[model samples]
Target chain A: MIDQTALASAAALLGESWTPWLVVPPGLLLGLIFGAIPGLSVPIAMAVFLPVTVHLDFLSAVLFLTSIFTGGGFGAAIPAVLMNVPGSSSAVATTFDGHPMARQGRHSEALGLALAASCAGSALGYVILLLVVGWVADAVLLLGPLEMFAIAAWGLTLIAVLHEGSFIKALLAGLLGVMIGMIGMSARGDMRGTFDSLALVDGIPVVPALIGLFAASEMFRLMRRDYIVEDKELRRPAFSRILAGVGMALRHPLVVARGGLIGIGVGAIPGVGAAVANLLSYAETKRRAKDPSVFGKGEPRGVIASESANSSSEGGSIATLLALGIPGGSATAVMLGAFAMHNVTGGPRFISENLDLVYAIILGNFVQVVVLAVLGLGFLFFAASLVRVPLRYLIPGVLLLALLGCFSITGDMMGPITMVVFAGLGYWLREHGFPVAAVVIGLLLGPAAESELLRSMQVSGGDPAFLLQRPVATAVLLLLVASLFYPLLRRRRRA
Target chain B: MQGQRGSEVALLLLIAGFAIWLAQDAARRSFSFENLVLMVPVAGLILLLCGILAVAALRRAPQEAGGGLARVLGLLALLGGLVAGLETIGFDAAAFLFLLAATALLGERRPLVLLAYAGIMTFVIIMTLGFMLPYEMPTLLLDPPR
Candidate 1:
């Protein structure tokens, strides 16, 4: 599997005068800062900087973009650790334990564990990608529209049933999310639920909706308190404690490895990337843990599970993009554009012709992990202080920033309106014991699932037996059934 | 506790009603196995889930009174107003008013300090989002004369 000439070419590129010493570091920082802020995501950063990459050589441009990709995988966990807010959907599960840890005065430790797990996971993802890209390329082709739809449905069902709420409420929330996600024009050019508004043509802007659902809603809940953490002693962050947290993360090798595997598997699937990967990994980790009740109340393993999965998902997304020329998510979509800009096609032909470049991209990501660790340490020193900011000031500041960020997303009043509307809805739903995570996941996966289902029906001419032809889709449906009942079985066993 | 149950029921009904409306719309658009664009099955599933939830809510025993309902609703009202006013009065002015109201509600007593904080915040947001980035926010105060 190892191509020696390609390895040498990768090494030669790394040895270039400007590649390692200057370009990659700044890209990582930009990605970190952009990703750490609510409303700004890795994809947004990549899109913003895509024009700038036009000036550089193909290798340099890819190196820069990949660094951002690597840095963003961890940077998104920052807000999730300190505040209850997840900067992006991928970090939603991270907030379950990361924020609780912050409340327990272990914010530094949570950040440290997240950082270490992210680094490990990213490296593992790349390793898997490098080794199995060729093999997986063939398997991906077998996964037709029905298989894809089944996979999404399975993920959403698992997430919904795993919520703390009543199973009915959870399922309702998820279904509602799917319905809401189908707000725009359908794949067949038929409008479903846009209410005849031009702005609704593009569907609800998800990042803004995410910001409102998590950040704004959480901030409203936190407003009554003086600070994120009440204890003055716990507010002070020490480098030693951070190191100890890193040690703690290192101790949980099994959790980290499991999370990385899950990340790679789910992330490899188009449209279902880090966002669902982190949620599924966290749910699995909690289900398997001896003290599952402690999960939402500040468990280091929870942070490790989510961070590792979300980070590793980056590598998985990259694999699909490279081997098949199919972008897994928005970030890879931007990368596909970058590929076009550089006149580098990314299918089988590109892999055969530029195997060296493929190796180079993977190698650059491995190097990015080490550099991310160093920069991330400096970032933590400043980030841990955020808990000390009074809630009165912090609430308005974050809301304002979120509003501005949302505005930037749609470039209109729709952004602010979406934030306001979703914020209210999220608070109410959360208060009523509806799992907001399930809803968000449903929204994210709905369009893809709907499109796939429609395509499958079209392909089969509406024959129900068409599903029998696809073994992968059948297997996925079986897994979905098993996952739904597993929780009930476990509860019965415990009883 | 009773109030919470009532609110939950109301939410469930709202969802069920919306699902019914969606199904009706799909029927108008030619709901069938052939019309792949008709997401009627999803709407039907939502209705079924809502029905299950409503039944569950009725059977489950309610407990514990919550106090922050008013606070949440108040904040939401302010947020709604802020969003509605953004395009009309502009983001800066609307955001400034929102900040002032939100801070005051959160118990910031000092009047001058509130004014300064809201003003500075609005200015920074406009500058950062409108001027620095390519984000196009409506701004009566900052826009060049037509």
Candidate 2:
């Protein structure tokens, strides 16, 4: 499977250009900045800088874009760790334990672990991509609407896994989220819960709603405290702790490897990218762990699982883009535009004709992972200072930033309005022992599940027996059922 | 304990009401297969979940302690006001006022500190974000010409 001649040519092509090297740092920095902010997403960052790529050669442009992709992958975890505000949907699982670690004054260490896991996951994804890019395209083709719906259902199982308090309440919250997610115009142009507002025509903007539920709600809770880190002595940033955190992550190589594998597999699916990948990885890790109870309470392994999966998903997504010309998510969609600008279509024909370039792109991402680690450390060093700021100041500052960021997202009042509304809902949910994360999972997967199920019903004419013909979907559903019941079986056995 | 249970019941009722409304709306919009496919089942599930939770809430003893309700509400109200003020007063003015009031609400006592912090941050955040973002943000004081 290794094309030695093409690999050598790719190496030569990369070596021929110094511009690509120069663009990597800036691209990574831009991605870090964008991904660190609550509402600014990787796709927005890529779209903003896409026009500038016109000046560079194709290799340099691709390198620059991928560097941003790589950086944003880890960049999102920063706020998730520090403020409990996941910068993107992909980082939602990162906040499960990362913010708890921060509150414990382990912010530096959490950031360190995130950086390490991200670098490793990205590298692992590219290595897998290098091995499977030739056939991954064909493999992805087998996933139809039924299969996609099953994958989404699999993601929704996270609501069950995230339940630590009242399972009933968690399920209620998750169902609420699903209902909210299904609000607005349906596929057949029928409106449900839009309240007759024109803005609801598109649907509730997910990112802004995310900001409200996680970040803004958390801000309200933090107002009771004086600073992010309760212990004043532990608020100082420690470079040593960050390094130790990296060492801690290194000790959990198996967890990182498992997360990377899951990331690649899940991320390869369209409409279900890093967001689902990270959650699935976290849920799986939590489920498999000896002490699953410690998961949401500053578990280092939680950070490792989430960050690794989200970062590696970049490689998985890039694989689909390169092999099938299909963008996995919005970020990859922007990359597809860059491809179009360069007069390069990304299909099997393109990959077969330009295998060397594909190899070069993968190889370049490997280098980016190394650079990301170095840059991420420096970025974390500064970001870690967030703990020292008094909550009185930090709360308003960050809340305002989130409001502004949401405004930027929707280009109207809808973003901020949705955020504020969800903030209230989120706070109530949290206060009532309802898992906000469950609600988030529901919101993220509900629309996709609904659309895919609708498509499947249309294709199968609503026949229940149609599932028999689709073995992949059947297997996935079986796995979902097994995962749901496994804990009950284990508990009974232990009892 | 009674109050807490009442609140929980109220929340459950609210959710149940929402589900009922959604189901009615979907059906009213012409019970087309596409419209009812996801909504009907989701709304039904929500009602079922709400029933279970409400029943459980009534049976369970209240054991959780509550505090910071006032602060959370104050902050939430301020946040709501900030969003409301954005289009009316513009981002810059609205943000500065929000920062000032929120800082005070959070217990910042020094008047000079509040004013300076709010003014500087408002300017810095708006100018920086305005410079970085591609779209135009409406601002009373710092609305730059396109």
Candidate 3:
């Protein structure tokens, strides 16, 4: 079964100097730097570096990028724990408890738990991705418009659980986001909120808006505060305490499974990336917690749920990229440019025809996890230095960057100004006990869900019953309904 | 504070008006099955829903503590200033001032450090946008030229 040509090509790809293990440190450190900076995006990193892949072969470049991606996921925890600033969207959950834990003088233990969970979840996600690629391809393709609609609805339900305040308020926030999304045109060729001005045509760029809202708002909040992060000497969690996480991973297989599945599912969808995966995983993990009291309170499982899903989705994301030649998210979209640069052909047929070369890429994830684990543990031992960085230098520079980034992105003032408004809106919503997570979920899902729904409707000639006609779509719709009422149902049972 | 809530409600009303106007415009276009107007009513209804809910939320919790009116008002003022200043202050001037003002309002320890970073960031963004990846704009606003 070992084909000669495939193995030879695989060897040629991995045959570079330093092989797989050599580029690990540089890849990881660079990722840490990106994550350390609050507003720098992963897609930006991948896109900028894609040209470099032209000189190297596909396997080498992929290995480097994968290492960077994994490292970026781990590195985001640095700021999340330090300044309560999330360096990446995936690290939002980490900041919830990780910062609190740092304040409590338990940085080492918290970080150790984060690292171990990140590695375990990452490995689990990768394993699932590698084994289930073909099966997932078949399964995802079977999902019709109705099922996709249900999935979006389910994604929206995360607002209620994650916000943990009022379901009605969460629904309000999600609906507001959807309404905002309606500002742009639709798949059916209708202009919305255009106001006769060409400038308002495209509605809003989610990435820029997101960057402005979350990243800039954070800076604004920091500027408004006169606060100090008191330095604390923390206990170094022993190898046993950290390794004890493996059993937790094994014991709460559902958490690991849910995170991995969400990661893969989110990864398979174009444009939606690890950010959604992390949010979905966090919501699912919180919703499923038996005690239901541990999230946002330094629970080890919370870290595992988020980090695992973030890292796990990387492998699945790559499969989608390779098979469909469609970029799964921001980062991989950039990787596609790299693939084109290096003249590497990608698709489902690309793998079977060259199985060894494909396996080399898959096996490279194993290397990424190993590197992530070593670096993560090493950093955890001395996490105090990371926590010691002063916000004074970072705060102002970051604020400047936020505005500058916004203006520069649109090359106009409208974009930067939008950042201020969105940030204010975000702050306002937060004050009102509305979950920021719900709004983000709604904003991310709105256009995609609406367009897909519209397309499906048009395809079925405007038949509303078309949703229930398909079995997969029906099941997903039912699941969406369940996600909404499950808590109320449980409350009734208790009563 | 009472004034603050009133202004927000007014904005909601304005937005609802805009939504109604947009829906009317959409309805005038092709009403065929292919050019569906279904989402228009749906979207308008959602806006009205937002208007109702936002007014309700504002009413329900009149003075939920923390974050003063100055900060809130200053944020609104910043948005207005940025919109007014763009295209005339020529991005660098506007951006530098925007960061300077927003950062100052936010509570940074030293303005000098932030201003320096703002200057550098302004220069880079301008150089990149103007030189590296330039874009064309047809008068960001329709007002008479200076």
Q: What overall lDDT goes with each candidate model?
A: 0.82, 0.90, 0.64
Candidate 2 lDDT, A328-379, residue by residue in tens: 9999999999999999999999889999999999999999999999988998
Between candidates 2 and 3, the TM-score winner: 2
Positional deviation of residue A465's Cα in model 1 after best superposition, in angstroms: 4.6
DockQ of 3: 0.25
- The alpha-carbon deviation from the true structure for residue A161 of candidate 3, after best TM-score superposition, in angstroms, is 2.1
Which residue segments of model 2 deviate by more than 4 Å? A493-495, B59-65, B143-146
Q: Candidate 1 residues A300-415, lDDT tens each?
A: 99999999999999998888898889999989999999999988888877787888889888888888898998888888878888888878877877887887778777778788
Question: Which ranges in model 3 have alpha carbons more than 4 Å from their true place?
Answer: A1-17, A76-114, A134-137, A228-253, A293-299, A377-393, A407-414, A463-469, B1-68, B71-146
Scoring each candidate complex against the real one, what DockQ results? Answer: 0.55, 0.76, 0.25
Identify the leading candidate in terms of TM-score: 2
Ranking by lDDT: 2, 1, 3
- Which residue pairs in candidate 1 have backbone atoms (N, alpha carbon, C) closer than 3 angstroms, thus clashing? none
Model 2, residue A375: what's the lDDT? 88
- Put down candidate 3 lDDT per residue, A1-495, tens digits, no spaces: 345676576566666556555666777666655655555545545554556667666677777777777777777776666556666666766666666666665566566656766776777766666566545556656766666666676776676777665666677567566656656666776776667566667776554566555655554455443432453334334455445544454566667667777776776765566777877788777776665666777676676677677777777778787766777776787777777777777776776666786766766777678877877666555544544544444554565455554554565655666676777776666655665556666777766678777778767888877766788878767776776677677767778
Error of 2 at A329 (Å): 1.6
TM-score of each: 0.92, 0.96, 0.81
Model 1 CAPRI rating: medium
Weakest 10 consecutive residues of candidate 2 chain A by summed lDDT: A186-195
